[model samples]
Target: MEKEEYLDLYYQMVLIRRVEEAAAQLYQQGKIGGFLHLYIGQEAVSTGLISARQPQDRVITAYRDHGVAINCGIPAKKVMAELLGKTTGVSKGKGGSMHMADVSKNFWGGHAIVGAHLPLAAGLALGDQYLENDAITICMFGDGATNIGYFHEALNLSKVWNLPVLWVCENNRYGMGTAVERASAVSEIRQKAEGYCIPNDCVDGMDVLKVRQAAEEAIRFVRQNNSPFFLEIETYRFRGHSMGDPERYRKPEEVKKWEENDPIGIYRNHLIAKQIASEEELDLLDEKATKETAEAVQFAETSPEPPPEALFEHVYADVS
Candidate 1:
């Protein structure tokens, strides 16, 4: 990667981390409502994978989707507003944290139901193929979601149709409270794709460079053969599944172990070691991200709530 690219990736990761941290803080302060899923440690997976996509390409993911939305060009302020249930929100305050959608940017939505979005992603790919567009659809989900019946159905259909879709399983070791081993009979997520005769691989989801390489390869394959592919990104989430989770299921030391391999810290050290960014420059980056997050929060707070009549406005389509 070029020096500028490395710097931009660092900035993107920092922005995602700071925004999610701020959202969590707001939720705790009662400023933001609804289910809040923080993508604290899984920054590399989204940043790396989404960076590989073209502007015209579409993305869909499960509820832990704030990072993807931001990566897809949605403003941080609008995302925070959505989490706060304000009118300025991406979903116009109707979808809250778990359902942010910006059709203009082609970020379809943040679906709350596990594995439910897979088929939708395949359908999106089908549309692109039918139109003779070269766009690819990247469908993301948690490791737990891989066990759902819809996942199997979606994969089968995607493979049968040879749709240009990449099924990414962000295997963060655990699904909600249940460990992957406990929840899945076959824990090898990548192998699951073979049943549908789709090519697959496992990626180091914590390393942005590794993720980018893997995603690029997958994208190339899907575009070349017009076939669906699957990737199991072996990553970890720093926070509990949700705000309410006490996380008694995992030990503190286990969390600390993953923290040591944090994508942000690892990338920062790599950049400095390679003389790409000075310590002062890195500090400035942190400062900038912090300030940006603060400004986004202020914007969300000052933005007006959705008008009472807006409830019915977006709900019903124009029939006349």
Candidate 2:
């Protein structure tokens, strides 16, 4: 990657952190309604993963998706608006935190259901296959989703038909309150991919560079082979599962230990060590992210709410 690209990546990671921090504050203040899942620690996963994808590659993620929406090219202003339930939101204030989407950007909406979106992801890949398009579908889900029957069904079908699907499992240690060891038959998520005969790999999700490399390779494999590839990225959600979560299951020390490996900090240190960017330049980016986030919040605060008459708008899919 170029020096500018590395710098931009840093900016994006910082922006995500800053925007989400503000969102958390707003949620606490009762300005932002519904379940607000902040992608505080796992910014590196979507930042690096999506950065490696082409425009045609489809991206679909789970409920914790503010970071993914931004990486998918939805402006932070729109993201904030959606969080505040403003009319200018990406989902026109309809989807809220868990349902941001821009079909033009190929970022299929984030699904609120645990494993329900897996089959939808398969359908997306199938559409591309039917149209004879080379584009691949990148479906991201939590480690918890894999435990459901939909996960197995989607994987089995993807391999059987040789669908171009890249299944990315963001294993953040715990699925809600349950740990992977307690819920899953196998601790390592990649092992499950083997059962479906899909090529699989694991990566350190805390580091953007490592995740990017793995994603590039996985995307290449899926695109070239027209087959499914599973990637289990070892990530951790620094915040609670959702804003309403009491977070009694994990200890404070454990959260602090993972906080030490904060993705933005890791990438920032890497840029300085590699001489890709100077401290002053990076600091400017941090200031810029803060300013951007502040402006987004301001915009969201002032943005109009969806009218009551438009309540039924886009509630149902238009097959025609």
The C-alpha stretches of model 1 lying farther than 4 A from their native spots are none
Output the lDDT of residue 13, model 2.
Answer: 92
Q: Stretches of candidate 2 above 4 Å error?
A: 316-320
Per-residue accuracy of model 2 over 75-107 as CA lDDT, tens digit each: 999999999999999999999999999998999
**Candidate 1 residue-wise lDDT, 163-194, digit = tens:** 99999999999999899999998999888999
What is every candidate's alpha-carbon RMSD to the true fold? 1.0, 1.2
For model 1, give the 10-residue run with minimal summed lDDT.
311-320
TM-score of candidate 1 relative to the true fold? 0.98
In each prediction, how many residue pairs overlap at the backbone (N, C-alpha, C within less than 3 A)?
0, 0
Per-prediction TM-score:
0.98, 0.98
